[model samples]
Target: MERKRSNRGRWTSVATAVIWIGTTGGASGHEIKVLASQLLTAPGSRDTVYLSWGHIVPVDMPIDAETIKDYRLHTPSGSVNYLSTEGTSLHANVVTVDEEGLYTAEVIRHPSIYTLVIDETGHRHATGSKVEAAKLGGTVDYSARSHQFAKALLISGDAHEGSTKVLGHEFEIVPLDGPESWVAGSDLRVRVLFQGKPAARQDVFARYIGFKPDQAWCFAIPTDNDGIATIRVDRAGTWIIRAQKTLPAALEDRALFDLESYTASVALEVLP
Candidate 1:
């Protein structure tokens, strides 16, 4: 049997826990975010990105491991298949860029159910479900998650090459246009797209990670009819933006919480 790597070794970082969108995203329907080594990275450099179920939020215990059915590095020409291994916590894949275009990373975790129960009585549960009536029972029924994340990396000396491309993902967020690099006082414009069109009136969030890895500043804005949400970056650092659509649960489970969520995000850096 293959020795499954511990969740801590999943992403190659100890500080891999993250919680996006304040209290709104309560570990329900999720968005797969790509945390790049650095948003403003040089071309041909070793860039490793992690596919996290939630944002860069601190999560206790080990995150439930879900097999990444489709992990691809997308470009205008086509996509390159990524060999993702199992037993790894967060599916962190590394990519090398030679041509400067729109590099979009797509991560898909097929439907799964994650349940956490306090097992103080030394009862080991094999499944991701609550055992009997354990105190503090939490469940996350994750439907098929299709998350598309894009980062514009124009090398230090090169012109834009590839055209803006979309892989026809369901829940997606595309950086329309803005300054090449964001500063302290800058506004970011992102289109909330669902199935190739704009998603109107949805809540979007941007979590800015400052110099201190332990702290972050969060901002929330709503998308307009055009499916665009503009938010100001008050500080300079790394920003992981996420937005989603929600609906009532198809089948209610009395033991679990209510509702389903679908999310998309931009995992990159904002210059100071």
Candidate 2:
């Protein structure tokens, strides 16, 4: 009887150890909470965003080695498909703001509980909620600064109206002859292409880069009766522009300018 009781006690201890390991296991299958240091600022800002989390545990009952799950970040701006392998805990790098406002980071598994980061000066608010049109009224002009600028393009778009303001700077929407919507950023260039050919002497709109949430930098320029204009982008990065071709009123169809379609855009990177 004594030997049997000792054997039972040994088995009970082993079972308890297994339960403890399964319930509070490694990083996998555990939920993680994160917090950011200061709201995300402008682009090229230092990636000092800090992340910290709680403990790890199993997903369900009868926890085993396979119960361990991974962690990830879903940012509003760039891709968050990649796992967050940074920091001591499962934390991700803070996102950069091409435009100001609120940004969010959600867990891959738990979508409900997420972190919100705001960049504006006053109260915290959401980003991309307000749809402001592009600034600068119709018939924008781009004159040659020193010499006849080559490789320039024209772009335009409808404004969300007062919805666009960066660092307290207000943008005005303008009407143009062509496409609506343009890319944003300084390192990018804009050009007009027709039938796989380049158009010259076009006037394009202009705006600051990384100032808006959309990261779209472009404006509208009115074309002469000949449908010619000159526009150029001195900066680099993605850009969008709009152009419209109106039909007769009887047609009951106003030509729509898809920003994705017919905009001069380029990804530019400048080196010192």
Candidate 3:
């Protein structure tokens, strides 16, 4: 009975070792990869920067074992220092700098790949991270136009995306030429209203419609002191504009104003 029990125990030990080696070996051998969107320059004033990326961990991948330990951001002059890994994405708080130059972030996965370098610049540079590009550039444009007017209001100026507000209305601009009658490069005015009342201090955006729908020309313009916002339609066409009022911690959708509100397509008619 002792001999039988001993043999059984030996077989169990051997099987356990085999399973451990097979499972651990493959997982330990897995390589670490990095990806990013386009590199960006921090706005001249802001210090905090946001970086986002995606990573794939294969099934059976070790949680704490094969994961990245930290990330380092390097500037043209010197290293900005290392940052700890936050789940899969790497984030860093950049020190404000007055000068411009190249910057790179290197991700370190222990005992595996030397380091995956993500290169970007304070001015402009190349980036190989697809995950980062989509996160940073995945913003929608909100702009529109009103129907034809003998004399339309002119709205102009610039605002950062998602930051500027036009009274209760929020909008993004897309470039489209009206009928052949409308002149290009000339300022065409459109009326903006909210609930039949002239909305004041509204945020307006001007985005140039590029050759493709995916490309946009956008700038934010705040409404005049009187709550009216005017935008120039460089190219004339039907444009979809959005209006909204934002409250603390919430966004109010005010797209549909009163019936008397300006019509959607603000035709840029040629002056007879």
The TM-score between candidate 3 and the true structure equals 0.24
Can you write out model 3's per-residue Cα lDDT over 62-140, one digit (the tens) per residue? 2342354444444444555554444433343444433344343444333221112233422121122223333444321
Candidate with the larger lDDT of 2 and 3: 3
Per-residue lDDT for 198-257 in model 1, tens only?
A: 999987766665423432225666799999887666556667676767665555443442
lDDT of 3: 0.31
Instruction: Please report, in order, the local distance difference test score of every candidate based on alpha carbons.
Output: 0.52, 0.27, 0.31
User: Candidate 1 — which residues are off by over 4 angstroms?
Assistant: 1-23, 27-31, 53-65, 76-79, 114-164, 178-183, 211-217, 251-258
lDDT score at residue 142, model 1, on the 0-100 scale? 32
Top candidate by lDDT: 1
Q: What is the model-wide C-alpha lDDT for candidate 1?
A: 0.52
Off by over 4 Å in 3: 1-182, 208-217, 236-238, 248-272
- Please, what are the lDDT tens digits per residue for candidate 2 over residues 1-272? 75565455434533443443344222111222223333323434433222222221101122121212333333333343333453234343544434322333322121111111223342221211112111212221111001000111111112122211111101111222122222222122333433333344333333223423221223444444433443333334322232322112222211211111122211111111
* Higher-ranked by lDDT: 1 or 3: 1
Query: TM-scores for all candidates?
Result: 0.66, 0.21, 0.24
Residue 218 shift from truth in candidate 2, angstroms = 47
Q: Which scores higher on lDDT, 1 or 2?
A: 1
